[model samples]
Target: MKAQVLIRPKAGILDPQGIAVEQALPALGFGGVSNVRVGRLVELDVEDPEQLDAMCQKLLANPLIEDYEVLTSS
Candidate 1:
């Protein structure tokens, strides 16, 4: 099975990368883009789909300031 993990900072958490991008967008000719948040995508092949969540919680995400979602594909 193929698994994808999407990891992102939790809401209300200060995101410096997101802030920097949001501030730079207007100067780069991109407008009206707000609430910009940066995240990570991890794609891998897993023998057990059931272990995906555990992977996210244990290592893939902080679980304190970050949240993760798992998607499995056949």
Candidate 2:
């Protein structure tokens, strides 16, 4: 199976990278863009699809300050 994990900072958490991108957008001639956020995507092949959640909770993301979503495909 092929799996992808999308990891991002949780709401109400301070996101410096997001802020920087948001600010830069306006100056670069892109207007009306707001609430910019930065996230990461991790793709992998796994034998057991059931273990995807465990991998996310244990090492792929920091549950305290981050949120994650897992996607799987055959």
Candidate 3:
């Protein structure tokens, strides 16, 4: 099994990285790209995305402001 973890800044928080990426998207040949939010993609060799989500809320991410989703594939 594998897990993909997306660690991003919480809403209403300052994300300079995301902002920079959003501004550079058009210059990088990406058309109509707006509101780009940069995040981290962590692919883990594991069992469940749900379990990972729980782990994220518990340890990986801050549930107070951050939003996250889980998807599992076999």
- Worst window of 10 by summed lDDT in candidate 2: 33-42
lDDT digits (tens) for residues 3-69 of candidate 3? 6667777888877888898888888898887677877666677754457866887976777766666
Off by over 4 Å in 3: 28-31, 47-50
lDDT of 3 at 46: 74
**TM of each candidate vs. truth:** 0.96, 0.96, 0.66
Q: Which stretches of candidate 1 lie over 4 Å from their true place?
A: none
Q: Candidate 2 on 1-74: residue-level lDDT in tens?
A: 99999999999898999999999999999999988989899999999999999999999999999999999999
69: Cα error in model 1, Å: 0.6
Is 1 or 3 the stronger prediction by lDDT? 1
* Residue 4 in model 1: lDDT: 91
Taken over the whole model, the C-alpha lDDT of each candidate is 0.94, 0.95, 0.73
Off by over 4 Å in 2: none
In angstroms, how far off is 5's CA in candidate 3?
Answer: 2.2
